[model samples]
Target: WADGAVGPEVAAAYSARRVRLLDALAGRGVAAYGRSGMNVWVPVPDETGAVARLLQHGWAVAPGARFRLDSPPAVRITVSPLTEADIEPLADAVAAAVRPSPARSYR
Candidate 1:
């Protein structure tokens, strides 16, 4: 499909979607790493919690632990099925999952 059904237009669309996802996450101050492809690696405080929280928001993401045990907690989010409209909401959910609350508050 890479050279046949998936032509330049298709590839470009995928790239755009990937970039949009990355930009959205970055805009929220979330450190996501994704130079290419549809998958984005977003580091979080807890991979399990982030995955669960994202699932609660109707997003099914894979925990980084499934791929690497030595790395810090993170979640893998794919932008394959995500449209331009879905980018912001997904970013918001990711941000919320990554930073649930302030580490400390002084009153």
Candidate 2:
């Protein structure tokens, strides 16, 4: 669905193909469709067609939820320069502060 160029003809073709696919699915008793952001960013043309096709096929759009957690701010203490003793404590403190959490861990 990544259309490099956007034009009337491309839009029409995309709409037609989407309808055809939906119709085929309907014939098989598949009334629901779930589309996620598989691509890093959805192209504008593809997004338009997707939304139109979903509504045309009687699908309802639902709002997605956002979940975020607030964490305590880190203490910043600037020094002119640091020796090995200063480096070890700072590194240890950072490692402890960055322990894995559900909201902050790399997936």
Candidate 3:
């Protein structure tokens, strides 16, 4: 962008990927707060637990607490390095990590 190295097509691709991640997460009933840029913020009940769970799925996300904000617990996920194929799996992992599971009943 600075040296005209980043063209419109490249920037468009980045924007597209970000939107894909946001849409995927929304489809899974996960709320994400990001309209532009490469990072999406997802609010979770427990930031630490969410981070740990996502890590277990091979995805590293930044805990909102790291930002020192007084807002609710959330995680920051960067979508820049993720490919188009990675969106669904990432969204699934995020949804699983952030949303509480229903109690299982053994019959």
Candidate 4:
């Protein structure tokens, strides 16, 4: 889940985008769910109410699950499906959004 204090308008926009993506997945008969920082079970068949409920708590559903290292309870990571097409565009967008700086550089 994405956690940030984005304005309602922005949040709604993100929500709408996610819903549309999920709807497309649903149409394809593909099940998807988002794993968030918070420990909560989100079911398939994503809907507005479910999305809103998650957002209210500062969580955004991605397309995966959260896993923890057996040896370290504190070590946890969220895994999501990624395709080659998604990687380049997503990286480019992130690069474009980040403010370039001498101290904190990203490519």
Candidate number of the best lDDT: 3
How well does model 3 score by local distance difference test?
0.89
Give one digit per residue, the lDDT tens place, for model 4 in 1-107. Answer: 24565566655544554444444444544443433222222233333444444345443433222442332111111213333344333323222222233475679
Candidate 2 vs 3: which has more TM-score: 3
lDDT of each: 0.85, 0.33, 0.89, 0.35
On lDDT, the stronger of 3 and 4 is 3
Q: Which stretches of candidate 4 lie over 4 Å from their true place?
A: 1-4, 34-107
Worst 10 residues of 2 by lDDT: 36-45
Kindly list the per-residue Cα lDDT of model 3 for residues 1-107, writing each as its tens digit: 44667777776777888889999999999999877667899999999999999999999999998865579889999887899889999999999999876789999
Instruction: Flag regions of model 1 displaced more than 4 Å.
Output: 1-6, 101-107
How do these models rank on lDDT, best leading?
Answer: 3, 1, 4, 2
Estimate candidate 1's alpha-carbon lDDT, on a 0 to 1 scale: 0.85
lDDT of 1 by residue, 1-107 (tens): 36576777766777898889888888999999878666889988888888888899999999998877688888888887888889999999998889876678779
**Superposing all C-alpha atoms, what RMSD in Å does each candidate have to the true structure?**
3.3, 23.7, 3.3, 15.7
Ranking by TM-score: 3, 1, 4, 2
Displacement of the residue 35 alpha carbon in candidate 1, Å? 0.7
TM values, all candidates = 0.83, 0.27, 0.83, 0.32
